[model samples]
Target: MKPLVSATFLTLASGSIGAQAAEIGATFEKPCPFGDCSAGIAFTFLGETSIQTGFSEADVEFGGISGLDFDQATGRFVALSDDRAERGPARVYELDVDLSAQGLQGVSVRRHISLLDVGDIPFAPQSVDPEALRLGPEGFYWTSEGGGSSQLPPSVRVSFPDGKHLREFALPDGFAPTAEGSSGIHDNLAFESLTMLPSGDVLVALEAALQQDGPKPGLMLGSPARMVQFDVLSGKPKAQYVYMISPVPQAGVDGEKAMNGLSEMLALEDGRILTVERSFAEGAGNTIKIFMVDLSNATDVSHISSLARHEDLIVPARKTEVLDLNGIGLRPDNIEAMAIGRAGDGTEILLLAADNNFSARQKSQFFAFEIVQRLQ
Candidate 1:
């Protein structure tokens, strides 16, 4: 949900300062966590663009977009901010998207909705790290990376379109924050990605492996992240699947650390899901790839603990690389959100948004890709 703490390393003078700037809060980089890079499956790259806000009509305090969703019925885009309330209240903005064959035409904020709790109060600044979001039948479904000290198990909640909290879902006890009596998610690395299945189930992904599962991702190995399918309407979990994440592509550069994790996900027809794996290194910039995960033959691991030992017992989701952000030649930032924006003409257009960390050095980036190949 937040950048890893930069580890101390020998600073190389040969690297560019811009690269060092990107390493702010970055941890020490390790080699490819999963040994080597697997070739990604191909997709037609349509167009791409970088969004510049705080200018003209686009002058909106729109940064920290940790989640994204498109309301087809309203032809509007929802960008959820992780800004607890520092700059303003935790909010989601409705936007008008202008996309043509030429590329990303333009995007403008139309309105904003403030998220609230059961007490009818806005989230205090830094109190909650709202990560992933999805459009739901009754309202919006979202996840929050509750802070470390609070012992708040990562949570999923339903909120009205106007930002009223309707209810919260129960998380598996293994995801508890304390490690004394129960296994738990690593602080700050809890729920970061979510999607709504056609079956009306809400699939939530933990950003990293649970503390008891194994060590955090390393260059020579991969970390097993869990995706739980919850029956949203019923407010109960239906199943869980293992979704693995490779270590950061490049460790650290010029003494800066590189890290990677699942940022967002979308459900497709059939029992498949689309996930965004985002990695970042100081000087290397950001690396984002879309992976198609097949849950058809996947085993439910909801009841399984310590995935490391049950590797042979758990049938993890089958993942195929779909698209790599570098192929488009745009300098990628921290791209943490994604959604299907439009589908027509035998292709689907995906809208991707980057979180700026509210840093002057970083620009909130938006990218568009016309997926020429449709998922079967």
Candidate 2:
């Protein structure tokens, strides 16, 4: 946390989307995702410095909220609620797009997917995966985290409305898959970030596992994180890209609670790939970094550059932790989603969102930045 950024008590602004023009706007319900003490904030950026963020869940609307997704077609949003677990219950709601409406807009329950529906995954006590969400190139692609103690393989399976689900194959045996928690099941593998390739392949992020010192399960060291390209047609890994973020790209990055954030990955229309990471250093509450990658130039793992290091459009947080803008321990207050969009002005914009961790301590907020031509 870089010295609390001097925050302004929350407020509401009503305008005709004119002049001061909304640069970015987000929508989210309560039981925010970052912490347990703060309300969730959300935003959707319309490029050209137009941003809008609001607390639509509990505090502002229903008095509580959870995980959510937006439907551009419906011009509305949906959130997940719960009966209470490590995370919370998996409740869903419908959000009205007309924020300009004065009085409180009522929320309606639509879908309620709970942890009990979580099957056999051995990971966090929570069911909904915080952060790692994307309108996957595969259309309707979302991910979940496992570890902590999940016996089920930490996997990312695509669940379709018709009941058709497609999942990446889990590593066989005690091979120990990497990502979230560990159920001690040999085939336990956790997937964090994911992107669909031009070839119709899915590039999935895998955080390799760690072996303990004492009995087979004492302290875990970690392998490394890599982008495993999978040929969906074959349901197997076709290629792997090592990540410098981890010491053992094959295992996982070392010396951390876990190689925390491998947020989201996207292959741009021009062929360049952009990836997001949350390197929460001691007291760095939630430090989000973006890397612009050129697969053509990236012969190996050594080719990725920090978006912050270069001048080409680096987007840092306008807000860090919900509590102490300067403190770290703030569990999950980082940008988990990013998408490149073009505005009405013919300018390019980068949109980002923070995972509230469904905790009252954090807010479900979204942010936006312009990836300068230099970074592009």
Candidate 3:
């Protein structure tokens, strides 16, 4: 076992985005002492940075970064903003992240692309809530949680690097949002996780249990979340699996606002996945947990319309707790995005981003971790 190390804090000079620089405060820590290391893999905290809340470029706001992915080809990071066109046009920003053996150096915006609809125009306000992003063979693949007020069903779409609409994958009927709430995804709890498998297939997962699947996660009982895998060539769902989400850790101060749900996922080259589950309470801050899930023995529930009806016969995906951020001795914000990147020496690095919700109280925080794998 690795000995516990103390935390180091640093205030890095602001990195320039276009012409303006955003101040960043960073913290560095050693490997998580409470993480599960029996699996021969571990995560060591590299460092973290927080951009100023109101950072902007070209008259567009730079908050609400709900989804993030690194592009090796371009050596840039693509960050999706879930603005819903309220602050500006829905968009994605390309970021340049500097890292080394010491830890994170700085982060800066490189480019901003406005997401366009079929009409080749930016989506109007209250029309889309993009939550997940992945770089694909043809273009960029992203998912929108959909809006209940606008009656927009959750969607998976591909677009050119310039943000031109390409095509959309047809979601299963169970994902459609309804006003009566008889069935379908709960409000603001649709698809929030997306990843492209090594085989070129696409996978998207729900944030929480669907209305028909079961009840939302509570203190004692977890919720059943669904994951749908689609064939990239056909844009059709090929398989679906259930992922049981951890219940809320603590009751909110108000007794009704605390919640926990799957936020994002990163597919490993070996067919496994690392999932991020984030919980937030009214008085307490966020609780972030990372789990490694293996789907090899998981039963496909594509034909099973409602998991609640056939709960007895389903085998949900097997998951093992990997890292719990609470043990790192730092309070985490609303972390909703995860991506894999590379350090200066080619070591694998894990990157995480938090959604500020365009609120002044919250922060646009980014974290980097070195991926350490021990050979047996």
Best by TM-score: 3
**lDDT scores of the candidates, listed in order:** 0.71, 0.38, 0.80
- The TM-score, computed over Cα atoms with residue i paired to residue i, of candidate 1 is 0.82
Model 1, residue 28: C-alpha shift (Å) = 33
* Runs with alpha carbons beyond 4 Å of true place in candidate 3: 1-39, 254-256, 343-347, 374-376
Top candidate, metric lDDT: 3
User: How close is every model to the real structure, measured as TM-score?
Assistant: 0.82, 0.51, 0.88
Candidate 2 regions off by >4 Å? 1-131, 136-139, 162-189, 207-223, 246-261, 282-284, 297-332, 341-349, 370-376
lDDT per residue for candidate 3 within 1-376, as digits (tens), equals 2212222334222121223212122322222222533334455567777887888878888989899998888777889999998888889999887776566776788778988988788888888899999998877899999855567899999899889999899889778978888778888989999998888899999998888899888899899999999999889999999899998988888786889999999987656788999999988889888888878788998888777887467888988666666644446799999998764445556889999998889888888875644222
Worst 10 residues of 3 by lDDT: 14-23
Please give, for residues 132-166, the per-residue lDDT of candidate 1 as tens digits.
Answer: 99999988899997654667678998999889989
Candidate 1 wrongly placed segments (more than 4 Å): 1-43, 53-60, 179-182, 309-312, 343-348, 372-376
Candidate ranking under lDDT, highest first, comes to: 3, 1, 2
**Which residue pairs clash in candidate 1?**
6-26, 27-257, 28-257, 29-251, 29-252, 29-257, 30-251, 32-219, 33-218, 33-219
The model with the greater TM-score, 2 or 3, is: 3
